[model samples]
Target: MKHFPIFLAMEGQKLVLSGGGDAALAKLRLLMKTEARIEVFTADPAPVIVTWAGEDRLNLTARALQPGDVAGAVLFYAADEDAREDARTSAIARAEGALVNIVDNLADSQFITPAIVDRDPVTVAIGTEGAAPVLARAIKRDLEERLPVTLGALTRIGKRFRRAAEALPFGRKRRDFWADYYFTTGPRALAEDGPQGAEEALNTLLDTHLNAAPRAGHVALVGAGPGDPELLTLKARRALDEADVIIHDRLIAPEILELARREATLIDVGKEGFGPSTDQTRIAALMTRHARTGAQIVRLKSGDPAIYGRLDEELTALDAAGVGWSIIPGLTAASAAAASIGQSLTQRGRNSSLRILTGHDTKGFAEQDWAALARPGTAAAIYMAKRGARFLQGRLLMHGASPQTPVTIVENASRADQTVLQSCLATLAADLDRAEMSGPAILLYGLAPRAALAEIPQVPEAAHGP
Candidate 1:
């Protein structure tokens, strides 16, 4: 950072300008917007500056720059065309401890003016750290379009509420109430009736929730991401915004949770393999109960709700109770894992079919239709198969699967700690055991694995027998 950019509040402060031409007039106009007392020194005043002084809009002196004139000024601007004069003015201003801006000479100045968009009380300043003012202005233009004109009104409403809110007994509780109101009522009011509407909305919210306890709510199964928030489906974001309660798993990143309404209840219901599991039935019942009382429940899952998310049982219970519910599909870990390695699971010639199955079956591997997974050109992606890899591999081999079939196990797919282990079907178990990779691993078998193996370097074979 070339310059530590800051917003200087110049209201009711002294500002000194040393020119009266078009460039100087522009700076004068900006300074006038603030409550600053501006003193301008010009050898010859421009027509525009004369008109402003004549109307008492600006205070000016028609004289050359003097060393004593810059004293006690908070900010100074030197816009003269003469380089020597500009440098002299800058040196004097700096010696006097005033932040100075030398127009068109970034290197000679201690401060550079930023391109500003003032929707006042909500001013936005854009700077390129004195590198590119034109580029900064272009960016500011783009931002001006996305920022609503009503944001100024919204900010004013917040100003109105600050004192009242601070006076409330419970800081967190008061902040929570206003936050909820700001999103729900205040925005709507601002959109409908501008500042007046926002004021009314804030007042109503403060009055209504003054003595209230936080409401009870159920959990929602929200899919945080396959990795990126931009990849989040519209439905997923909507679920998060509406959720009164969020019970997210460990796989969901903090960045994803930031999308939720700031005041929404957040709970970590994260569980790892065979560790302190949250009862599915209990979760379902909690959601059902919360929904009955008009609370929005979100049970945030890691991936697409339909894929290995235990949705079948939750949906069954929700439906049986007649609770209104819906599912928002997310980028599943399988798709993300394949994407991370740049290997398409449904590659045309390498694999014509895709099968997703879990390695662990409650009834054991004997009950699983391992034969179906042995088909040629079929690619199977196994979920949570680290512990049962040996049994599962043996079953696939017995069911006519090729002993040399390519396999890839991806752990923590799409995450920073992601690791991919490539091995043949014969060595799948030993390779997995050697890597000691666990926690929701995805197993890719068959031709897709062949494609992936062909792309990535192979791992050394395990010493143990296949």
Candidate 2:
């Protein structure tokens, strides 16, 4: 943020202004809402300023501002609407050791007034560092409509009962009590009865929650989506929001992890294919342990947990431990990869069926029905195929697949760094190696990139004939 926002206590503080024009009037309207002792200096005071002084609203000096006029002031506004006068007035205020704001001059000002949504005790200030006043006003208008008029009154009531609420344990317990009061019980009571009813409801809520035990912990197997935070499902986002603990995979993006609560525990149980890994048994044990302690746990995965994510193993482990769990499906890598190339997994006339196959399993490269996959018009999205590219190529070729079959590799699918490379089966391995692709990629068979075609590499005569 270029400008840091802060709310200063205005009670008994002095605020000085140096104009009687529209610029001054605009500042005065908002200042009148505060409890500051305001004084305006203008030789020819506007009629509104004269009326305000007559009504004991503000002190008006019918003379030009002099040195020491802003001596005791905490804040000063040079709202003369004249650049020269505003600068001169601002200099004097700064010399007098006060924070000064020159109307419509961001560079000359030490402080800028924000568009405010006033609800007495509750105030929302929107500022854009003087770069966008219209945008700030739009936000202020939005907040004005969304926030209830009675929110200030409700907050005032809450302030009074803060000490009483301290009887409940600090942190989550106390937060839960307020969340229930403000969101549920208080609003309902205020609607049905009045402020008195709301107060009564608050007391009842505190009693009920304080006397009850804490909520049970849960595990939500949430798909983090194909490296894009936007693709995350609403349910998955909610799980991150409410989770006290986030147990995420290695492939999950940092942006996705950012959605989780700041106070939540983040455990990176990343399992890389044929690399440093975490045991599934230990992961399951970790889930059960945290769940037993009543912490809301989110087992975050990179893609759809149902698709080769070993979801059943984790589910079985949780079930055996008597722990409850749920799933929030995410946009798998295959879908994201296909979208990046502007091709459908199942095209009406091109291919009748789409296959999702992993490049490797527990015993290195996985075995599949290569004869069926090698047939004409076959389309498949191959995940984790980077290292096993040669093995896959050899197997398909042995099963009588054509060396000229189209293939595309989508690297870091759905992410900003995503790359789409097209090649034929004869050069699939060579193209992958030449690209130096690092992120999780999906190999597409019988599909090509929508935009540009990749330069096909020359295949050796031996591999082609075989």
**Maximum-lDDT candidate:** 2
Query: Considering every candidate listed, which one attains the maximal TM-score?
Result: 2
How many clashing pairs per prediction, in order? Answer: 8, 0
Cα-lDDT of candidate 1: 0.77
lDDT per residue, candidate 1, 1-466, as tens digits? 7878788877778889998778898888887888888888888889988888888777889997888888999999997767898888878888887989998888877888888888778898888977777899899999899887777777777887888876555534565676776567877887788777778877778777876765543345656556557768888898888777787877787778999988777877676664577777777767787677757788888888788788888888888888766677788888877776667888776567788888765455434676777655568778778888898888888887767777888887777777888787889899998998755678877634434555643333342123
lDDT of the candidates, in the order given: 0.77, 0.89
In candidate 1, residue 414 scores what lDDT? 77
Per-candidate TM-score against the hidden true structure:
0.66, 0.87
Question: Where does candidate 2 stray beyond 4 Å?
Answer: 53-58, 72-74, 452-466
Residue pairs in candidate 2 whose N, alpha carbon or C atoms collide under 3 angstroms: none
Candidate 2 per-residue lDDT, tens place, 249-316, comes to: 99999889889889889999999999999999999999999999888899999899999889999999
